[model samples]
Target chain A: MIFDDVTAVWNQFNLTERTIEHLWMFSIALTISVILGIILGIILYQHKKYAEPALNGLNALETFPDMALLVLLIPVAGIGEVPTIIACIIYSLLPVTRNTYTGLVSVRPEILEAGTAIGLTEADIVRNIRIPVSLPMIAGGIRIAIVFTMGIVTLGGIIGAGGLGAPLQTGIVLLLPDVIIVTGLWVGILAVIFDGCAGMIEKRLTVRYGEW
Target chain B: MTSIHPFETIDRIELSHLTKTYGDVTAVSDVSLDVIGGELLVLIGGSGSGKTTTLRMVNRLIEPDSGIVRINGTDIREFDEVRLRRNIGYVIQQIGLFSHMNVGDNIGLIPKIEGWGKEQIDARVHELLEMVDLPPEIFSARYPRELSGGQQQRVGLARALVMNPSLFLMDEPFGALDPILRKQLQEEFLTIKYDIGRTIIFVTHDIDEAFKLGDRICIMHEGELVQIGTPEELIFHPETDQVAHLVDANRKYRHIETFTVHDLMSPLSKREFYEANMPVSEAMAKILSDETGIAVVMEGNNLRGTTSRQNIVRNRKKNLLLGDITTEPITVTPEDALVPVLQKMKTKNASSALVINREGEVTGMLIPDSVLFHII
Candidate 1:
């Protein structure tokens, strides 16, 4: 019966609109998290004394469950896509920040010497030499954040944030197998597609950036 | 052996009273030296001898604890450190090429930073790659990982030269390459040195390399300069036992005064001929090894003098000619002692002497076989 209703529910659902909302939340959250992560990462890289506390803070954020983070945000920001996106951003910070920090600090000393010896100004060294050299590793972090953010964005539907997770959460409450199965399938398919796209972008960046 | 321009003889770089210490260990101590424009001054010493520290201070890479670095008579401290460095090309043994950048980008970086136009930078990059013997068409797009060690070193050299800096500081630039490749690069760099005519401070631990590439070698020991002189002077007139020991390889060969062909040679004969004005040591070596063991000395292709090893052995006249000795005779002045003369003869690979006066006129001959016969 659920197998037959699965097609029925799919026919009634606006797959295009729901999928757009899912990706929109994931992308915006990922963009915000990546920018913040990069800034924090650079700060940590430049001031190694602050790295331990900053890294421990990021690690602590990772231990806090995404659902609990969203619930905690409800008191201040209230419910819906805003808190969901905030939670997703917080959850995604660990990988991007850690990778960027590691990548920047790990650039070989000889390479830095060459950069300085060539008369590159401090700004030029950071932007042209340090950043470009560390891009691939930073991209790796972004990829991980993309996948992790996509997972947390699914939970956005529980707080009336309109995404594929909405119908899936509704299905669980109404005891409807077709809604659960069909919405779950959509979420799974969207996650794979988003992850695949992120992976392709990271691969392209790694190829262009080259290995040391 | 490239002759530097006469007008460019002014001191291009001067290090006055330089001293640097690292936690009670003096890396370089009270060193003052002037490097003439267009001259390659090679600083050579064993590890911890302060050669590298002395070099780095010129570019202010390592600021001295107490000293002054003057470039072209201007205090380097007055200029911004970055600007000072931009004018000084630096190459080290470990290459340090940017792995992220392709060959063209790596070489063009300094020029680009100096605000060179894009097209001009590109052209310069191509020209530099060609100078380093790397084809730009094929190598421009290739990353450093795609190249061999020697190729990477060439790129490093090109990168340093791209800005056409007036001074170059090279610290064992070819030391990382294999022996054969190192020698090949050294020879190639020597040719480039003449063409560029930039003042250079080359730091190397290899005494032989210092002798080969340096116009003047500065030998340092225990953070102090032991001596600084041309290779010939260092060998012939070493200032101390340490200086003599360092140049011991060439110390045994005393510098013979330049004698005219008429002084050390006799009149020409009809046999095999050689240049009359050639160094007697060189001419004697040739005659001794020649098929006939005699050579007619020629001046501008005309027969000027003749020498025969056999004639000197048979002739016992007090005024015997240099040509009369059975063995190639060493040329020496008569003030020399017998033992020193014998030792000098042995070192020169000769068995007799053409004893000459202050005017380089041949006074008599010292034949070893006759001396041995008379003594017995």
Candidate 2:
């Protein structure tokens, strides 16, 4: 059962190139999400008026269906990893951006007052106390985003982005249950592994900073 | 010692007509007071009474909407904010040692920022750790999480003192500590102050702490100074009902000068005399022992001193020559305050004091009971 005739189908499936493309798409999406999310988070934290609007926009983005977002991006960037990554990044940004803004703002007032009283410059306060203390929540947000994007990246393969999802889409149309189950299992395992690692990092940061 | 510089002599600090408003609420209003150099002046008030706001205005942490803060003869506004803050040491109740850095790095920050060489900064950090009773080798490499609350505070003090700034601004540095730890830190701060000789502006809501550490206390109410004076001046003569209530809790520690042996010491009289060669055994029997215990010992035309029961018990021998068995006792002059005398008693582990005169002779012996009587 471990290496049934389904193994033959999987072996000839070109899983290597598909997996690489999948990883490429996932990485591109993650990188873009992290960069854009952090910028948006910092802006939301620093700008008193921007938080509500930015959060509302993110909530609206979250409500949009993943397939619909991919469809929306296709017209702009065309089919393939580019549109796939863009759609996945938009899907992943909501949690990270919102969590980062909340975390930075919720730092204890006493801690900040102590920093100011000790003659720390405004920049020093941000660099030294505010950022470090808010790091656990920031990391948590990123973790959630990564796991959410990984699930979405597989669906991107439906549009010819080239991943395990391509075989998955083909298996579904061709009624090949073996390919569908194997690819789905592997992707699920990868998501769990990635999220577990991020959870560990968040735990360590919390223990160090006495905050989360 | 190098000759004192002109700047060293400039000790006075004055905040005149200070005011601060946050929207509709005024935090401080028209507050003014002069603090002498080398004095630990504590600002005591309840929460929202403007004590912290007033302290903040001195260092320009909170810009006063109006008024001037003068240090020596110059206004603080004349100095750049960064440069002014660099010249003053600040410690707070939370003990905010940077969690990211190890102890040595935190303590070395000021000297490093001041552009000292690596060797000098390291040496200064070592000196400050020892001064604050933390061994550098043990604590310098440890991060803030590894230390206890009290240890963190000690490191905080070391960090504040690292630059050897001329003035210290402490905002309830012991407020977060447990009672026993708070007492220990207060005692340690006193020793540090005596050694460093820095003018200190301290803020505390605790009346007992204000009395214990302050050379002069400034009582504030609703954004204004209620009264400012020495502890004795505040206790014996409070200027307002608010000050009296503020000090009422600390009246016992406040009047410690009255309980000193100096207060009980009687002036020398011609009634007592003895030859220099008097036998110790005979002298012990001749001196009357009462509830107060022991009598004064006069040699020739001068007063030698009193001998205590504890002294006799320690030097027990049959022959007991006065010169052999009797030791010259420690005494205080009439002008010495009871607090210092009590401090000496605690430090030297002594039971009583001898009052001495201008002629280097004992005027009278002062026992603990006599001091207690006067205090009660």
Candidate 3:
């Protein structure tokens, strides 16, 4: 009985297409977040004096409500995927950029001293020693971004971006128990799966590059 | 090989009035020194003596507040700090090998940074590893954390040496190791010095290590250069009481080192003499009666073998001849140092050794009890 109900709801909502859209949004937002996070992190690390205020500002943005973030982007980006993806990137910036900055700056002083003593250029030291040593931390930051990206992408349905959240919102409006149960459970499961995969990747990075 | 070669024909380093102050504290004060080309000049002092500060200024790792440092007679400021360090090898106590890189890559880094080919870098890295006694096949792929402290330091040495920079700066590279390992590395360092040492500035707080490894040691105290001299010169002609105390504090045994065997040996005529034909029972009795408890068996003025109470008693029931029980005696010249003479006796498992003159005539006897007293 339950299987029949699930299949019925799945087809009614076109979950196959929504899953694709959901994942598509997630990948784009996460990619942009990581690239920007790393670049922003490097900039902050190079200008250490500005790191405090810049990070505090990012923290303030992080504390801004997620629903409000999506709502605010609507006026700038308008409805649909652009605003949704933009919201995901915005929320993810703090974790990725902060972690990247922390990882870069927290490299062992002796290791940095050794690099300097060996006559490595400033750029070489950053690329070879600092970045490689910070891999585990960077991976940790990316893992957090995955969860943020997944959540923001799902919420995009409220703005007519057409993902699993659309069906969830419909089920909520019409009070269709089957549609709510199936879509809500599916989105939750998908988020868990993505976060779990990222978690595994983070662990592997830690094993490979973590300081003893 | 050219990497080990200095930038110019001679790399004479001159530091004049080099001083560095951190706010109210002076790290190095008006330290002027001339390090000769290819000389392994050691800067030695207690902690905060400004030796490390002095070393860092040579490569501009720490710029002096005032004064000039010249390498190859050219001011160090004239060259890029990065390039200057690239041509000078550096090793430190912590042995900061990149935790992420394997042994081979750690040593190969300088060459790779210099834009050498992959194969050439690998070959050079392996060669440097061999110099430091790390087998390339086993250690090349192992990370720093996988190795022991001593092994990590060896890799650190290899990394510094791989590019063959003509000048080497070592900041207590073996200081973190246990005494046995430190001594072993010091011996190995001397061997490496024999092979490829350039103008090296080695900094250590250990006076003994300085005396052992340095051709000349520069002593620092409280951010000032106190004395600079050879080990012998420092011992015999220390210019300051502070410098004298630094040397004399650990040099009690050094007096024995200076003394020859003649200073401690006894007249051979006073030794217990027993004939080879004597009964084992009689020889054992005589050996037990003597203070040295040793018998120097003689065959009509020609030295036979020597036997002690331990030797005679172990064979007491065997009914053997005195000659059969005795072992060859260790013979040393009267001019030999007491320490080495003691070493010979210890290695040969003999309590007493025969002292002989240039004429091959047995002259004196060496008892280790007297040597033990010197150490105690």
Best candidate (score: DockQ): 3
What lDDT score belongs to each candidate, Candidate 1 first? 0.74, 0.75, 0.83
Error of 1 at B370 (Å): 38
Q: Which stretches of candidate 1 lie over 4 Å from their true place?
A: A1-6, A43-49, A175-179, B1-10, B240-245, B248-376
Find the candidate with the highest TM-score and give its number.
3
| Per-residue lDDT of candidate 1, residues A120-193 (tens digit) | 77778888778888888898898889878887888877887777777777888999987787888878887788
| Per-residue accuracy of model 1 over B159-234 as CA lDDT, tens digit each | 8988677788999998887654565567668778888888889999877678768899999998999899888777
Residue B131, model 2, lDDT = 77
True contacts kept of 3: 0.71
lDDT of 3 by residue, B192-297 (tens): 8889857788999887788777888999999999999887778777898888787773455556668888887778564567788887866755654353446788
Off by over 4 Å in 3: B1-11, B249-251, B254-376
Stronger candidate by DockQ (1 vs 3): 3
Please report how far candidate 3 places residue B73 from its true position, in Å: 1.6
Clashing pairs in 2: B257-B338
Better of 1 and 2 by lDDT: 2
For candidate 2, lDDT tens digit of each residue in B169-189?
999999998764575567668
Judge the docking of candidate 1 as incorrect, acceptable, medium or high. acceptable
Rank list by lDDT: 3, 2, 1
